[model samples]
Target chain A: MENQKERTTIVLFSGELDKAIAAFIIANGAAAYDHEVTIFFTFWGLNTLRKDEAVNVKKGFLEKAFGWMMPRGPGKLGLSKMNFAGMGPQMIKHVMKKHNALSLPQLIELAQEQGVKLVACTMTMDLLGLQEEELIDDIEYAGVAAYLGDASQAKVNLFI
Target chain B: MENQKERTTIVLFSGELDKAIAAFIIANGAAAYDHEVTIFFTFWGLNTLRKDEAVNVKKGFLEKAFGWMMPRGPGKLGLSKMNFAGMGPQMIKHVMKKHNALSLPQLIELAQEQGVKLVACTMTMDLLGLQEEELIDDIEYAGVAAYLGDASQAKVNLFI
Candidate 1:
């Protein structure tokens, strides 16, 4: 029983601002409860791990276009709903500040501090042409099999 | 030991056609593995359970507007990406038919036949003004707490 810690895994598949926030909030909450948590970022969810600055990495035209089109990082993601252009993210950020809730970046920091494992899906990175240098540091890189391994054993797994 | 069924739970939170198909595919896959699967539909996911035809339920102006704006059922939902107005869903349906893949409605039907528990979020119903008559039959109406109870015991829980 000592080695059997509670485990939780989350697959963040959406790039929307609200969904990412919800994913992190739940991850942080689970980590606080002493569960071993992992957030597997795939598809558009990879945008959450990207650096805000443009990285000078040579890529094929389609890959470059994908990288250009996806959001740079947590700050630039748009809302899944009510995104009146870029205003929805601004309003949500404003409200979050007003309510003293931790920002997305801050939530990531907290999750890292809480020892929640952050894994970026390597297959998605390859397909989208995202380089490790273009993403934030301290996160591990892996494939879907690794995620399934963690998920099959976890009592609370979520695809966000 | 015979009574201890492997449990899995999925929270379908997106209303898009592709996302719904993915949710059901996974749910069906798990159920095929003999896992007791529960798919808790919340927010826009409830649209998947809506009847193809509108029910003549009296509702407030906001509720009526919401009902009008949201998709009526699986056939009416849009794709999350590459949704060129309404053409994307049509193209996906065509491809699905050609590939002999189960359509979204058929997937839901298979889920029911596999004894997968299809649950609609009751709190969301109150907020969205969706009445029981508006949804398809045989689904249990529940809230988040009920979902949590199931999720806590399940080896896999996903919020899609």
Candidate 2:
């Protein structure tokens, strides 16, 4: 039993930089511990997977407004607290750099390099009018069923 | 092996109402599924465990200031997003009530009633100058080791 590999599934629900950092930190830790890890990106979480550059996608007015209002990518995400009208995230980034900690993009890269499965939710994409081209390459696209399938077999599951 | 009881551990690290609701919802779901569940409240998360009424406890100026700056209890906690000077939480609560969803305090009560083990981080308590008497009764007090003990065996572990 001790030799059996563990499995972890995380449902990334929040798009805030701090929460994304926590998710990646846990995912990295689980991967380091020899666990199979999967992160399901849904709703705002999918924003973290978006590329820094905007993708030209046709959309209705509301959809376009959503695209405009929400952060385009991980770098634009605001902090969950002390956001003083957008200054907090920059301050946190500076702190992270000062401490030589990995940035969100770097953490995402590390997670991918460690073979962590990243799944973008199809339902949310449709609702938010996000296109696949807007996100980074090499990620699986699935619905909640895919997430549940992984979660059912997981020894560790988290919704963050 | 199939008959062995599965365990779930949640590290409730945020005190915001939205996050707290999510944690309780997940905790309740796990408990309903017959998983042995534990929620380790640390740092800001301890604010959720605080009683609404102020306790007659003495403290230093900094300690009192800390208490004053933070939400007194779950009832006073703000939302993580769209918190337009505290109106967002009230609006969300209204919507929750309209949808017949459990309120945050009710969810906490339900989680407790469902046999979820609530563990308060002692180190964070000392750091924040929180006293046991100020929190809701019938909770375990421990440090990181206790949380790790639970997490080490948990079939589902979450940092929320």
| C-alpha lDDT of all candidate models, in order | 0.88, 0.86
Q: Under CAPRI classification, how is model 1 graded? A: acceptable
lDDT of 2 at A9: 89
Candidate 1 per-residue lDDT, tens place, B1-160, comes to 4688888899888899999999999999999999989999986789999999989999876678668877999999999899999999999999999999999999999999999999998856876679999999999998765676687678677788
How far residue A60's Cα lies from its native spot in candidate 2, in Å, is: 17
Candidate 2 residue lDDT tens string, A1-160: 6776788989998989999999999999999998999999876788999999978988876467657767988899988789888999999999999999999999999999999999998866765678899999999999765665577578678787
- Using lDDT, give the best candidate's number: 1
In candidate 1, which residue pairs clash?
Answer: A157-B157
Q: Kindly state the fnat score of candidate 1.
A: 0.51
Native-interface RMSD of candidate 1: 4.7
**What TM-score does each prediction get for chain A alone?**
0.98, 0.96
Task: Give per-residue CA lDDT, model 2, range B1-160, as digits (tens).
Answer: 6777677788999989878876787788778877789999999999999999989999998888888888888899987666779986776676567557789889988988999999999999999899999999889999999899988877678888
lDDT of 1 at A35: 78
TM-score of predicted structure 2: 0.66
